[model samples]
Target chain A: MAVTTLEPTTGTVPTRRGPDSPRRRKVRRQAWLFMGLAHVLTLKQYLVGAFFAVLELLFLISLPQIVTNLANLVTLGEPALDVPVKERPNSLFMLVDGVITIALILLFVAVYYVSVRSALTQERAWPPDEPTPPRRRLRDTITGAAFPVLGLAPTVVLLIFFVVVPLVFSTLVAFTNYSAPDHIPPAKTIDWVGLDTFVYMFGGSATWTAALARVFTWTIVWALAATVTCYFGGMLIAVLLTENRFRVTPLLRAIFILPYAIPSVVSLLYWQNALNGAFGTVNRTLLALGLIDSPIPWLSDAWLAKFTVVTINLWAGFPYFMLLIIGTMTSISKDVLEAAEVDGASKVSRFRHIVLPLVMYQTAPLMILSFAHNLNNFGAIFFLTGGDPAVADTTTTGAGGTDIMVSWIYKLTITLLKYNQASVLAVMIFVVLAPFAIFQFQRTKSYREGEL
Target chain B: MSDVVVRRINTAAVAIIFTVVAIAVLWPVVHLVSAAFTPGRSMANMPVIPFSNGFTTEHFEYLFTQTDYLRWFGNTLIVATATCLGTLLFASLGAYVFSRFRFTFKRPLLMGMLILQVFPSFVGMVAIYVLLYRIGGLDTLWGLVLFYIAGNMPFMIWLVKSYVDGIPRSLDEAARIDGASNLRTYAQIIVPVARPILTFLAVTSFTAPWMDFILPKLILRSPERQTLALGLFSFVTDKNNFFTTFAAGGLLVAVPFVIFFIATQKSLIASLAGGAVKE
Candidate 1:
């Protein structure tokens, strides 16, 4: 070990040294490098050293197991006829365990780094003017940096083992052949098929390419239409209500909020039941009213099903923006609107020039966020259409006429057991949504001034 | 001015349009509520107008007696309550630490969580299912509760952290001076003062599981372990024609939920719009 010594004490005259003294400067420099042995290791140093050693020992002991898991993750468990059934290695288990092991190892490495850096920080601040006791130093460290570590430990652990591990495992599934009937574990093993799913999805086969193009374009269209329709439709109601002209405004407001107040699953399912083509209430009612030649195939025809989903979505969706816009509009000062009105501006002009701009300025971010929300609105499509009115190609491609990427992902995973394809779609979704996430992140309040 | 004439036309037009839209909006709601009390099991036979089909309680009776509706409701309540409590506890601890402590990678970690929150939780369906199977979380309410708590952490933690940051550090310092430990100060001072925001967090988190169907449907395999969403959905599937019963079960959940939502909507709306406006 590298050693350093302090200057010898003067016999008569005391040394006139500032903070740049050799001993002080050397200690600071060595602390940062996490090097050099002083004359004695304080109790705090011993504790910190012991902590690092324990982590190191744990990592070393687990290193072999980790390697085996990672190897299994790649190979996905080879076939062993000689092995008993109970001892058979399963590919899916290996995959999940491998992911968990990798996550744990990453956590271990991170903690190891943090402990070392913390040790250095403590060492740099060592030996206070009063020569703090080692026990006091350790306690000070605990109350300082270690406080956050202890406080957040449980949350971090839960997030990792539950959230992060599963996400990583699924993302990894995108690159492998982990589908049903062929590569399922215990019966057979999975092998990595990098870029094959991507190629197959994008342009490898005509049917898949057609499905991808159709679903992607529809998803974009649906998101845009849903956002625009809901935003403007809600704005209309909010603007009208803000007129405050009616004595029954409160009652109407209550009536309007019923859609928003009810749980979405219940609403969607109820609408699905109500709109059933043959015996549903809507069709029967229309027939009774003499409003149709015959029963309308509301959810049966592909084009009509798409329209029905969007219109119904408009019904379920508009209330949120109504509440939101009303809140924003109420906050606007009365002066701006009055000023526009006094200038001989018509009601239309006043709305176009003043109220619209203010509301948009305030709620544009939310609109963008809502657009992102609509892209993956699984229940809106799932509960209503159930991606019904399957097109000719739906058998070959998992997508239905009304299926958004998210709902299609659901169908792929649950009904079809097409895990690999589902993961690929999930990755595509991540790629598509990443930009929106970054934009939203930048606009978040805490992000702007998180320094505090 | 000619503008006056136009304004009158516009107001009349707005009134007519509002009336039409209002009728359209109330139509389905009335139909749903009336369907719950309608005499028939078939949805096609039920009249469109409210109470036109004649009121009956057979559906509600069937829901309570013949089906596992109560068990499903209980499971939902247990799972939702556990998720809410767990999210509150962990999120508060995380928020407190983040707000008060100066640690490395805090900013990046927060940013990462913000990004991750955008990805829908169902994207990891396969892995979560397999992971649950390994841990025996399948068909268990606690497994569903565990997933929800973990999923809720990132967003709820950020929300509460922002709220906690507004709280003056002086409160913590004063508690410290009074010989209170850090955890004690957090529990005593920070939490009580942060109650309003915590209430907002509680409402959002609690309401999520009630609306969700896919997660519960995936994790819960047993008839006894089904949630309200799963149970109610089962009533009107392709295989079954229990539309009236489904409506009845749905109404039970909606009535109380709507009341609760309307009551807390003021704070909920503020909390929601607060994020956008903060920019």
Candidate 2:
């Protein structure tokens, strides 16, 4: 990270005389006069420039008074309107006063511009023939500083406005009692109730705690079940598809990707319908084949609901895993696989000993990410069941039997209009998921660098 | 001879396993599309002989006539296209700078982008809602696109920048020596070379705004502004004839991406894996 500086071709100093000399002073004065004229010309180039310039000047002059008035309104909770009519300024009157003040400020700016131009003309400092000083270097560096800042400004502003600010606000809401009727108008103010929501959410009733525990347990179960199932499922598919001797490998790969190619919402919705409790094709076919006496409530019962969501997730996610694993499998050097073959290693042994480990090592971060994704999986659970099979007698608002943290957050925000509570849940979810995200990010960064 | 024959048998057996697994993966989807035109209210009510009930386009027709399917499709296309274009422009410029420049605070800037990616998209849901409400973007397509880009920019920058980094620096130097300005160099030399990864990014980024339900549902409160994903949700939740039409709509949504994947599967697979490794 050493800074590389290029050498200047000539001595930094020009042959011009000192600024105190008559020649230098004349050049400096002329430069000032030219700059003043340039400023006037620039203003003339745009029709509204003069107007805006005056407006800008007025804004600058009256900014302090404006700030004071704003502070008064904010701190005093709106101006008292019941004061004596003769003594009191009404809010409308105050607004008018502000406008007049701004107008006077604009007039002042018009006058100041004339004076500043005359001053700059009298004391100009320019002309490149003069030797540049260390101060010029400092000026150059200061101006150059804006380059990187300008380059990064959009990203930084976006992050602050969209990411950082939201995160802080959400975290703040988590400490307050911000839910339900308390969230309604005027009475709807988000009251600061420190840890009350968390305590109520995690404690209070056994049912509340039990419901949370169930969701958390299922969240972990879904993440694990989905990740592991997809991982092995993908690995197996990749291995089969990539085998050199396998004819029609392209056709098989295409078939394998059908699930991945389809949008998750479409597939998930279709599957939800297909797995309907009574007349779903699966149930109908199963019963017709005499597999079971009763149609299983695939989405109504809690366990069945959880199982179905995972199964749907598996279908939706495994193709992605297969695609990724196949890609990683191809990148595995041929020599190593050939070496395994030369050693007379059986196909299973070669896969178990060589291929699986290599692919896992390469794809470990993605697997971690997939796990985190499943934990916060709102789409599958949402489109499929909308977190249905409502938990019995649960006091929580919209806590479905199958809701993950995300769907629950959705329930709070969109369904119940409990922004404060939703914000809290969102922050809590971030806190839980942040570490895994960090790990994935770091691993990916290093992996990228390694590839480079 | 004996060993070779055994290995051949094993390979055939492996291929057979794959064929079966492929069928298993495809069966549900195939059944779904078939059931979409099953010509009955429920599966139980349908004739046992699949197409014997007579093939029908009723589900698709129902989707068009009953729901706001066309509106949803148009909204999704507009948002997805705008998002793709916006993402490509901003992410490419940002990634180019990150990849090429040696500047102060570069590490911190890169790190910030990475960290931003990790914050769940939903965390910003409240803040964005308020911000958009203030700015009058509520229930608007533009509001959805803005949030979509904001949610997606970090990952796209990281992905695209890494791909750009893999291109030889000499190519840039060569162009510069030929009197190409920085902008020209990027536009002429770098972008063309990086087309594969750019396609990957465009498709994936476009797919996000297209497939996303949560953001559109939260932002687009008006039924007319609903994207396909949100529009489909209406039918899925209808609890009646909507389910069959929902399947048809789902098929409609899936068709384009599936066709795209099939057409560009090779490049898509290559770039996806390349991006993962680069990541």
Candidate 3:
């Protein structure tokens, strides 16, 4: 992660000449003046800073003009208070575009600001050669900053345009009255309603509040169940396969991974059918075996549907952990286990004290990530049940028995066009899930190694 | 002698359990294969085991001839291929910069990328839909491709960056001293050494767009432009039947993916299991 090769400036020197020292600080203050600047910087470094400084000026000039134009249209071009929305025409897109452009310009300013600092530091670091012009120091700083600055520009641009812009747009959407009848743009005008939607969602109505509570509570429960079950289920299977006791280890591994290998949509769809209440192969098989009196309503009953989807999720998800844990398990040194054995540890104790901790430590971040993943796992809910057995009571909030927050958001936006409410749910998800992602990412081997 | 006897017994017991679990795991595959060849509308009579109702090529024939399956496959292939290549090109550069360089926002951006990884991009579907609608990208393949590339970038960059981090910096320094530029050193030295992780990212990025249902469902409104996931999904959802046809398509989807996954399963598991993440 070391990018630059430029030598440290005289700022790091311990002598009275150090940049932060009293006399040196006085000199550096004077150095900000045009006359003082010429003393500290070479002509070449001036050109680089001047070039970027001009670009920064351009950004500052252009961005506000766009914002000004949008502001003018919002104010001067507005229809009277009683005028219809169509007569008013929507200023939302123009406003959003202008604001985002300004943000991008500020980002540009920040990037160039750092670049200029390095250029100044470079020119200041060198020992004065007679006339105090060092072309070498100029070249070193330019080289130091050039590749990284230039290399990262494209990705940073992509991040802004795609990730940042969309994020800003979606977040802005949360506060606006952009829902069904009176809010959708172009045909209808949406104004910021502040916290009305959130208030309604949380404290306004008893039914709505209860539904929100129910969906969020179920989402947490589902995440825990999915993670815990898959973790141990995969562990059980992986441990069995790794004993050097199974003759068909390779075949067993392959078969177990099949669920993970198949495209999840395909498997989820098949299971949705296989476990069908009526003629599903699952019910058919069970009936033939005389295990059930009749077909179980696998995908319809409220509580049963949640269990059904979780079971199917386990089927599709376990192989991932199974594979991952088995990898961790096998890589455990035979010598370590034997050493534990020599210490008179039983199999269970050795596993408890040695094996499980080591593997858990390695896979802990992934386990956290997996839980977050299931939290937003849309397909598991969408395809398996489509939030079937919809709780009639929760219609005010548009959730169902099996509806996780993500799926609930999908329902609100796609099925109901309740975009405003959906945006709130989406924001809620990000708020809730971002911390887990941050925590898990900070725990990755790369992050732990301080690579970032 | 007692220990040997005990070990032998353990092996036998584990072997029997493994067989049962293996069969249970493979049950879906067996049933899918059977349904694909079963000459019927729904899987009403097709037995749980293969060949219960005998096999035929009719469902496969129907999937190819009577529907837009081929077109969906073609669209998926194009989207997946473009998404894979685009992800590699962009993600590798981002990863290399992240692995090899320090900049102003390096730490924040790294953490930001991590945060972005879990930010359900599906949340932006409405915004994306409206944006693309204005841009005339709705119902277009490139629109889906653009989103997939952007969606895959953060995770791919993080994964590849971790892999690149494990490589020694001495190689970079040596190359620099040998008169190579920073880009050259990364391109020639770091990338080659990072091939296994790169391959893993490529396979995953390729399959990600292939399996994605939501984005395609939201974007591609027309039947002709539907992806495999969308097309196959519509069979059961939009219709009351076509179980065999759905099975045929699903069976076809699993074949190449399962084989490829099994082949490269080690690299995948290694990278993901903190093996490739280690310094």
Say which candidate scores most in lDDT: 1
Local error of candidate 1 at residue A54 (angstroms): 4.6
**Candidate 1's error at A208, in angstroms?**
1.7
The DockQ ranking, best first, is 1, 3, 2
lDDT tens readout by residue for model 2, B21-81:
7666776777767767867655455443345566788988887887789999999999999
Interface Cα root-mean-square deviation for all models: 7.4, 6.5, 3.5
Lowest lDDT sum, 10 consecutive residues, model 1 chain B, at B270-279
Please tell me which model should have the higher DockQ, number 1 or number 3. 1
Q: After superposition, how far is residue B212 of candidate 1 from its true place, in Å?
A: 0.5
lDDT per residue (tens digit) for residues A245-281 in model 1: 7888877877788888888888888889888888787
Pairs clashing within candidate 2: A184-A188
For model 1, how does the per-residue alpha-carbon lDDT over B1-279 read when each residue is reduced to its tens digit? 597897788778987988998998888888889989999886876876779868799988898899999998898899889999999998998888877765666766777678878877777888888899998889899989988998888888888888888888777877877877667878999999999888878877887898898899889998889998898889888999888898899999999987876776666566656655654
How displaced is residue B173 in candidate 3, in Å? 1.2
If you score just chain A, what TM-score does every candidate get? 0.86, 0.69, 0.83
Lowest lDDT block of 10, candidate 3 chain A: A6-15
Q: For residues A46-136, write the lDDT of model 3, one tens digit per residue.
A: 6655655566567657866767755743442342446665666564555456446656666765655555445444444545453444565
lDDT at residue A241 of model 1 (Cα atoms): 91
Clashes of each: 1, 1, 0
Compared with the true structure, the alpha-carbon lDDT of candidate 1 equals: 0.80
